[model samples]
Target: MAESEERRGLFSEEDEGDPAPDDQEGEPRTPLSPICDPSHLLHRIVVLAFMCFLGFGSYFCYDNPAALQTEVLQDMNLNTAEFMQLYAWYSWPNVVLCFLGGFLIDTVFGIRLGTIIFSLFVFGGQIVFATGAIVNHFWLMEVGRFIFGIGGESLAVAQNTYAVNWFKGKELNLVFGLQLSMARLGSTVNMNIMGWVYHEVGEVVAAGHTTLGVSLMLAAVTCLLSLFCALVLGALDKRAERILHKEQGKTGEVIKLTDVKDFPVSLWLIFIVCVGYYVAIFPFIGLGQVFFIEKFNFSPANARAVNSIVYIISAPASPVLGFMVDRVGRNVIWVLCAVVATLAAHMMLAFTFWNPWIAMSLLGLSYSLLACALWPMVAFVVPEHQLGTAYGFMQSIQNLGLALIAMAAGSILDTRGYLVLEVFFCACLCIALMAVVMLYFVDYLKGGDLNRSASERARLQKEAAAHSE
Candidate 1:
């Protein structure tokens, strides 16, 4: 009951004052900062730049096994079934831990501490993983990956909390998109470079298998870099809290397990959309190279190269699409557009005789578009305090889907082949389209303006300006 009242109070200030009067046509007014002051806004952008690096190491290390699958198998003397355990280990624990991690952030540890602790998990896990590789202890590596997953997804939740804290309602969409773009860039970099790193290490060691451990150890170096970024970001967040005196201000309601009941129909719809859309993309990409090599008659090298086009395109374009969302504020429209594009991409892959490049590129663009526009909506519906839980729960659900669907898709591929796999992905994407359309209706019933970015920005700016006055 107290929590409900707290939440009501949190959102009740939706239009606390008449908006700051608009300037006349062709009249000049001082350009205002998005938040408390211009200096603070500048600081926020710098924080965002640091936020870009928080997940870099995790992203790089996450796909290392896939990138060097053959080398890892040979180095560990493991068959395909055993090698698959690596991903399972990374994903399984996250399904539960991410939600608890978010809960801890909101109720117990707070964002700064949660980030540092999660980052330590990432760093420590990498060290253990690298050690396992060096010792040819496959179980040890699994343990390392388990620990890494605990940190990886929870750390992502922490990053989302930080983003909402600093950027909510003012380019929040763009910020989330930028963060994802960086993470995807990290993945793309690992895919392109890990093989080279392994080759380079092999040359220096001048041995057949001895270099694999050392090459894998290089990933630990990236994790260490990520830990450093996390620490720095924590300090910045602390300083912002202190200098801005935001601690004593109106804050989010304290989170409770029962608070799940408070999540609106729109948030649930969004969650469903998140799970379905990601199941369509990430799992397919995991198996896509093989699919391409088999179905398109491409050479192994070229197939892998073409499969990478999705990440490469998304890496640079996500932030730009996010900026467009910020400017336009039609988040539902953008999300639906993304779903349509994803469906088109899947249909082309499944049924068409067109160039594969066109299909892959469309998937990339739509992936970027959905990601940027989708995440910020949580900020719109949920208050600041529970942002951690909101993001955490979404990650947990998404990871569960990723873990389950990857296995299912792989099983289907083994039995039925590429066409069947495409059908499965297309089906998930269609569900996402339906979920997104439902979101549009829910937003419309509540007041469609929530889907518009420009008015929200203006309102936030007005609130900030009025508060400053």
Candidate 2:
């Protein structure tokens, strides 16, 4: 009878011990389990699609001025120097504001608040620009563009933050590519249709034709749509936070300006690459329609058509290239390839009499490839808490380059010729290639694993997990 009693006591002790440990462990794992489950895949995709919508309007309005460049110059009776201010105004203010904006997103404001506020700036700026156009006040238009610049690039930082928040380490590169693709699509649609909108609206205004202001007003409508998407995304993000308990076990880190010092040498090299590559591309695009007209002797309409091929091809190709990067993981190699292709394209434009279409199409592809490969690396290197500031600083530098280069390129075109500008572009591409090479070496020395394919990275992740177990 005493032996039977002792056996029962042992069984009771085992039961109580198991429950104590299980209860302690289960609480933490409960919140994380849902995220790892495949069932949440649809939720993630929907979230990504919403994120894409947030930038669509910003991209559309940003490019509209370039799309209607000739019309704005002719209607406003402005010289090229004055007209280039439209781009300069959009770029110069963002030099400092983008960094601050990113700081706010990381610390003071958080992603949702920053995105909404920046988007509102975009909307308000577009509206003010349209009003300036209606009044035929050049100063007012410049002011409006300046205001738009305040929000434009900063909003871009917020968008990056959002993508990292939701998609980091889970097809992140591909998601960025898709976001860029959507943005480029907005620009492409603007290129394809802005001229038509201008002409069509003109026909409607009692046959006297509409003013450039009317076309601008139409672009403002797109800004408003983007603002609406921002609000919707904010709500959805909040809901997800609540449902997933994403913040339950987390502490908010205080973001400091000094955090900038922590970024690796590789990131700085990437920034220089970004500035060089974009200076070669965007400023050229800002001036490209004129290039086509001057060099190929094409009409304004035809020039725009040729210029837009970059955006048009990028709209579809960016996401695909991003997916390949996600699967393959040779981001640095792809970026180098892009730099080479861009250099070749500019050379053809500068030196050869080859069909501009061939050169333009190649440029479009290169632009897409670089974008998909380069931007995601920021996320890979920087901690999530600092991503906003990191992305912002990069934009600030990029904007500075773009602002200075656009103004200078305009002056150069007026004084020298398209050949000089094309040569300048080639020089920028060469510098980008050099920076990219430096980046590759820095990454290699750090064992960043950025040089590996996506599958290889995944294999490494699995091996680490097994070893830990």
User: Which predicted model would earn the best TM-score?
Assistant: 2
- Look at candidate 2 and give me any clashing residue pairs: 202-210, 328-453, 328-454
After superposing candidate 2 on the true structure, give the runs of residues whose Cα lies further than 4 Å from its correct spot: 1-50, 106-113, 160-177, 204-210, 234-255, 259-264, 378-389, 439-469
Return the TM-score for each candidate structure: 0.75, 0.80
Among these predicted structures, which one has the highest lDDT?
Answer: 2
Kindly list the per-residue Cα lDDT of model 2 for residues 173-256, writing each as its tens digit.
567667766777788888778888888888776322136887888888888888888898788777666544453111122235
CA-lDDT, candidates in order: 0.73, 0.74
- Where does candidate 2 have its weakest 10-residue lDDT segment? 1-10
Residue 69, model 1: lDDT of 62
Report backbone clashes per prediction: 1, 3
Q: Candidate 1's C-alpha lDDT? A: 0.73
